[model samples]
Target: MTRLGYQVPNFTYPGVGSDGLFEAVAAQAVEAEESGFDTVLVMDHFYQLPMLGAPDNAMIECYTLLAALSQRTSRVRLSALVTGNTYRHPSLLAKTVTALDVVSGGRAQLGIGAGWFELEHDSLGFEFGTFTERFEKLEEALRIVIPMLRGERPSLEGTWYSVHEAINSPAPVGRIPVMIGGGGEKKTLRMVAQYADESNIICAPDEIPRKLAALDEHCERLGRDRSEITVTYQTSAVIAPTKEQAQAELDAAVAAIPELAARAGGVILGSPDEVRPIYERILASGVDGVTVNLPANGHVPGRVALLGETLAPVVNRS
Candidate 1:
């Protein structure tokens, strides 16, 4: 499980042009690995998320970036924060992650969720189905994907996806951890209890308790121990040398992307000492770990290192 994961969700840096963008990203990954972070994740989206910036903002393909990061850093596990199930077939998705695992020397984790971002789906010609339909597709995809990852040949005849004794050759270097992301109590948590090695709860700190309880109920109902699966919380942060500096950075971020302010209440913003207590409070809520994104200044050269230093002790203490 990733006790402290650093997510690189923003690709547009202030002065680093497109030519130097990848080097900038790789630097952050290296810094994260050198620091205390155990894993590095990227968002699986085609366009810049609406809340982050305009659609045209720099957004690279997820797996390609992860595969590249594998060569730059030797320790940190590589994965998309959560792959959208609607983008590719189950068999292909499994094969892709398996290849990544092989190349990364067995440090690969699969994080998946029901596809969202209706704009991307429509624009890219993927099926933009209703919420229920998307979940149905995700469940079917998992049924096929899980077996394939375990080196089993699974054949399924389902509405959304079907495979005939699909083979996953050159199996993963090791057991690829499966992480299901979302906080839906009924369907998502139920699936997580049934098939995932980890459950990433995408919510604020105040909601962690309820999400954990819901996951527990599902695990109990399925005759599974809640402890069998690791639980990780996902949120954003803004860190600097002092509280005022962090606030100023956050204010500038909100000014550039107005939509960010709407979710500002949930973002953790402060210096190392100021935010440690907040992370401690979240850990006290029963989450096994946390994966935070520094949306405001993560692309800056030493920011991820600072974040890793600040949060590693708090997370390791738990």
Candidate 2:
């Protein structure tokens, strides 16, 4: 349901350290709300992701940061970009998001995915199962989570998780939209067609049409309305006042996080004028929403605001 979202996936920045990091994050959230971003998200990871920095870089727990963010700003929806399923029990995750909804006055969404960070699991003492096993666990977890979100106390005897009439008491004030992030055609898209209210995918700009078409086919096979699920692209962007400046910013970004340059998919770089057409093309492909990775420049004072001011209208128009 969110048309435009901003993600703060990193905490370490040029001048801000751990002592003032959360305050800086809170400031970005407030700025995002003021600048027309509909939702604010933090990455649900234990370590700083490889592209961003070393594992030991300052990474706060996701839900804790979201709870703190709820107090600092009003109106913007809050969520993790996608919570890794292996880290917590399904019932606990359901309760946590519900609590977030209650605290934020019903502005909460649950974005979840099959756990991917093996290193995080290994270090945190969670089971690092085979890919098939992880997806199996995610399937079972959703059965428990979706029912609880809808106010039903589901009893499930699943292979990975079992709950006997798990009650989510003091239920959330409203429905918390469930967003599943991933683009696996056979497994993930099938699950999205069956259970998710939204799907977030990362792909090359030109690959969007094919992905959306595949999702449509999945919906048709499941007898689900394609319109029922909002399709959002997860991307990274570079923006600046002028074309040359934007390119410079992007070069600096790619230089710092070489992964951005290596993996060109889902990374858009340019000034508003240049970036607008790419958004237009993607929106024309029928993407209903977007959530961007802005960690590289998001901590800078006006960077988030500038992004919102420049790109929000472009997205909204398309």
Best by TM-score: 1
What digit string (tens of lDDT, one per residue) describes model 1 on residues 1-318? Answer: 787999998787777788999999999999999989999999999988887887878899999999999999899899889999999999999999999999999999999999899999888899979999999999999999989999999999999898999999999999999999999999999999999989988875788889998999999999998888999999799898899988888888778767677767768989999888899998899998999998888876687899999899889889
Q: Which stretches of candidate 1 lie over 4 Å from their true place?
A: none
Which pairs of residues have clashing backbones in candidate 2? Answer: none
- Expressed as tens digits, the lDDT of each residue in 114-217 for candidate 2 is 98988988998999799999999999999999899899999998899999999998899899998999988889888999999999998777788888888889
Using Cα atoms with residue i matched to residue i, what is each candidate's TM-score against the true structure? 0.97, 0.94
User: What RMSD, rounded to one decimal, does every model reach?
Assistant: 1.2, 1.8
Model 2 sits at a Cα RMSD from the real structure of 1.8
lDDT of model 1, residue 142? 93
Error of 2 at 169 (Å): 1.2
| Best candidate (score: lDDT) | 1
Angstrom error of the Cα, residue 77, model 2: value is 0.8
